[model samples]
Target: MAARVRRTTRHSSRFAAGSILIAAATFLPGAESAADAPGLEVPVDYTCRFPSGSHAMTAVITGSIPADGTAGRPVEPRDIALALELPAPAVAELAGLGAGSVSARADLTVVHTLGDETATANWSGLSASAQGITGQEQVTLHAEGSVPTATFGSAGTATLSASDLTLFLSPLQEDGSPTEPAAIEVECGLTDGSDGTLATVVVAEAEGEGEGEGAEAEPEKPVENGGTAEPEEAAPGAPRIEGRLPAGAREKLEAARQDVEALADGPDPCPFPPIPLPTPADTYVAGYTNVEKMDGAALLGPAHLNVTLMKEYIPDPCTSTFKVLSEAEFEYGGRRQLPPAQGTFLTYGFMPTTATMELIQVGGPAQIESVSVTSDPAMPEYTTVTAEFDLRIRDVEVNGVPLDVGAGCHTVKPIKQTLHAFGTGNPPSGYTVNRGGSMDGETYIPAFTGCGADEDVSSLLTSSISGGGNYIKITQAPLCVLNDTASVDCPAKKPTPER
Candidate 1:
């Protein structure tokens, strides 16, 4: 059977937990401040470009922001509530999509400026619950979610302004299955050419640190840009860890040292650095996994490689826009075919059956929709990365019998598979571009089509395999950096198959 996938960059990253404080400036009427200090209403007009057309919307953002904050501490927007009024035409468009109800999530980028330095945070994950669309009148969506925090290590006046706004819409039928298009993404910006300044916060130094006159003047400190600074030396109270010597550890360390020294003398294989920019950088990815069959049988032989020898682009940090410079080149000059997976399992709960399957690439190379990198100001060394992609699967067999699932046999719709990875300083958690990791998600196996060479058996396969929530897990090794050998050596290793 073949499965086709669709990939798009919806929202980038999830906000890491930190301190709390959120406020907004008023550009429209009905802006009010609560007696409780930073609680207020921020009204602004936005122009959102939908697939149908552009429409005007009025959004009232309600949140808490402190008037004064301490430096060296993180400040997160708290109790964020967004009340967006949708135009009638927008409602009609949803009705046209066969949507009885609609739900949405949104991301709004906030820019913070302190003196000449600037930082950014995403006020993301604002979600609105499902509500019926009558298509006769305007609809209102109330979205609320937590946002990422911003840290200021220096004392100054930090200005917060709104930048880009992205909306992800999910339309569903009465039975709860998604509509034909499934999801819709919309891009929005301020209606007028004005900087949507939400609020102004006065940042003061932390308590108990002061300088009196006649004391020697301290050196000028560097301005911070949403990141914290590490101390020059370890704290006296902090514990130090020392590992006991292990046998052969010294010899292994020496061998690794010699290999590094040899690479220093060798010519640099990569001509360019892997930086986040408009320019695309190509890297090779090799992955392996043990696919769990519907019969509770695990395909263990030949190692079901989800993606082998596939090329991907380095994600741009500032924005979510990217272009594929060119199609990936495999050893055969095109798509790389995975070796057929062979395994034996109980066919019908008791009958042991042997099967071989090939995972054919449905489209071209998997599309790298978006890449999001988030670092904690408290622990700057530890960072998290999230990436999304689209791929397809094809071909199946049982007892050496060809299922004959034609080329069109695939998932009825696109399913999203998200993978995450961590940085070097952090412990291994998820899939990272530099160090390969594991990815697990549920995918629906649609009913088989064009089966049976001698007699039709598509119904038998469909009855056994077609359904939602088929679990799949894939592990990837460090990518072979084709353009940057110093970072990652060429000829990436194939990961041992993971459940």
Candidate 2:
């Protein structure tokens, strides 16, 4: 039997009670407060998906924490209610096990930033109510539980998907060794304890069941632990768990893990350092960022724009006018709100796109006001994100040609154009926005390079920026995933995926 949970410091290295038995010990990540700013309140909208042939569940994410910019607080789930649906075959198999009906009870990890590392808390309020036997059995599951109120060590976010949710039963260690602490045993009698009957699942030991065909049929394992149910052995490699799993249940488990839906937007988030311009609000939202430096020491291609400073006359500069803080990645496919600007400035040749940005870099305060992300009708599996941005670049250095605003030849007027960019995201993150074609059309200061009298760079801006067909592709420098909030070697996704 698992020991009763002993609540410890919120920043402790281990989980409570039954979780302790599993040894899910993790380190806490910390969040730095940005000017006692009001905590961020990000709305949650997520969906939990199972691999092919399984089902999906949707939930909302809500959180709060004080920071200067976007991300800076622990995100708590207002609730986590889901219905686990099984495939028809699994249902049929359940009937064979003499079980007229079955239900699933699993846990989802509430992920958040703690101290200086990623921390996870196991949430297990999953409840299931019998939905009347419809067809035959494998294991048609349903959940009717809610998440408990909790907080992370620091202010941040968390997300739930099949990969990040659902409890895994270990029958053995990765090296095929017996799992530590051993598996728990329970007896599922033929009748409920009441009525003078006790029906509880029991763990049965047997000779190893080889992996190939002609192998003994896997048992019919029902989802373990529902509302009020105690922890049961579920991890696959542990020691063959005796449950409601059907013969060949191993394949079934692997299959379910494959087809997961991107999570819905909640409080969960990730990366990128903000432009260094001083700002008011000190809040920073979590998400991913990918920055690529130009070969000729400029910002070009990858994100769909080529910026090479007129080196002979000026210096190389790079900048992006797309701000998508509150936007959803692979999860919710559609429009989203931009992160509020804590501090924005219109800098020139003076700042680097990232802390490590060395080549040509330049840009001013810009916003993505609003964006629309959808899937391609043809591929359906791919995500398509489009932005309507307004640019207000004041004196951007090109090839070192000083953006002399009122100068005769280089009468560079601030750029204020509405350019459109669309790109296909690689599976997970859902973004590969670029320059001119259907994919890489960046904004170019065409028609007039120097001065122009019309511009509106307000809350956000969008414009196709490029080096006037000078998509000078060259050997570039390695990308960097710099992060100041976490300890050295901490994970990063901003500007790019931090290794």
Query: Worst lDDT window (10 residues) for model 2?
Result: 196-205
Considering every candidate listed, which one attains the maximal lDDT? 1
Each model's Cα RMSD: 21.3, 26.5
Give residue 480's lDDT in candidate 2 (0 to 100).
Answer: 18
After TM-score superposition, the amount by which residue 146's alpha carbon in candidate 2 deviates from its true location, in angstroms, is: 3.4
List model 2 lDDT by residue over 392-460, tens digit each. 234434334433322222212332322222222221111222111111222343222433234332111
Model 1, residue 389: C-alpha shift (Å): 16
Candidate 1's displacement at residue 43, Å, is 1.1
Question: Model 1: number of clashes?
Answer: 7
* Candidate 1 positional error at 227, Å: 17
Single out the weakest 10-residue window by summed lDDT for candidate 1. 238-247
Steric collisions counted per model: 7, 128
Candidate 2 Cα RMSD after full superposition onto the native fold (Å): 26.5
